[model samples]
Target: MSRKLISSGSEFERKIGYSRAVVDGDYVFVSGTTGFNYATNSISDDVAEQADQCFVNIAQALEEAGSSIARIVRVTYILPNRDDFQPCWPVLQKWLGEVRPAATVFEARLLDDAMKIEVQVTARI
Candidate 1:
């Protein structure tokens, strides 16, 4: 199949020149997604809440890519603080408990200070 781009209508997609997700052949590659509520353009201070929102954003992109979170084969989590990772476990379990895709985590600075967590995933379409 030809490559397809999925957009979330986030201004960053325009400014940074990246789609929310890209579908190529049997796989869909989702971009690193943050917790900012696109509707409100605001983020929460709570890490867990941010984690949950990350999944929400991911699910939307996957859906647009003709896939679902259940189809995810790989996942990567990025956090600005290592200590913030544990608090996001319950939220992670809530979204990925069954699918349990191969995962990795990294502690690194994000583009914005308000972003506590970012998630990226690859899924089958």
Candidate 2:
């Protein structure tokens, strides 16, 4: 199949020149998604809440790309504070425990301080 781009209508997608997700052949590559809820145009401060929001945002992009969370084959989690990672375990397990995708976590700064977590995933379409 030809490559397809999915967008969440975030201004950053236009300003930064990146799509929310890209579907190529049988796989969908979701960009590093933050906790900002496009629908509400807001983000949470709590790390665990932000982590859950990150998944909520990611799941939407995946669905738009003809994929779903269950199809995720790989995942990467990013947080500015490593200490915050533990608080997100339950939220992470809630979304990914059954799928059990190959995963990694990194402590890194995000574009916005309100964004406590970011999630990127690769999934089979």
Candidate 3:
């Protein structure tokens, strides 16, 4: 199939020069998403809440790209503080249990202090 771009309507997408997700052939690549509530442009202060929102955002991008969480084949979790990782496990397990895609986690600095978690995924359409 030809390339198709899916957007989450985030202002940063154009400013940063990237789509929220891209569909090429049978693969859909979803960009790393944070907990920033697109409606309020605000992120949660709690890590677990942030992780939950990350999945919500990811689900939208995947669904819009003609894919679903069930189709996800890979996932990546980016956390600024490694200690906060365990608190977010239940949120991850809840959303990822069915797909249980290949996954990785990293402890790295994020752009914003309020953002404790960011998630990215890949799926087959």
TM-score of 1: 0.98
Best by lDDT: 1
Rank list by lDDT? 1, 2, 3
Against the correct fold, how does model 3 do in TM-score?
Answer: 0.96
Tens digit of lDDT per residue, candidate 2, span 8-125? Answer: 9999999999999999999999999988877788887788988898899899988888889999999999989999999999999999999999999999999888888889999999
Give all TM-scores, in the order shown. Answer: 0.98, 0.97, 0.96
Residue 15, candidate 1: alpha-carbon lDDT: 97
Q: List runs of model 3 lying over 4 Å from the truth.
A: none
Better of 1 and 3 by TM-score: 1
- Write one digit per residue (lDDT tens) for candidate 1, span 28-56: 99999999889888899999999999999
TM-score of 2: 0.97
RMSD of 3: 0.8
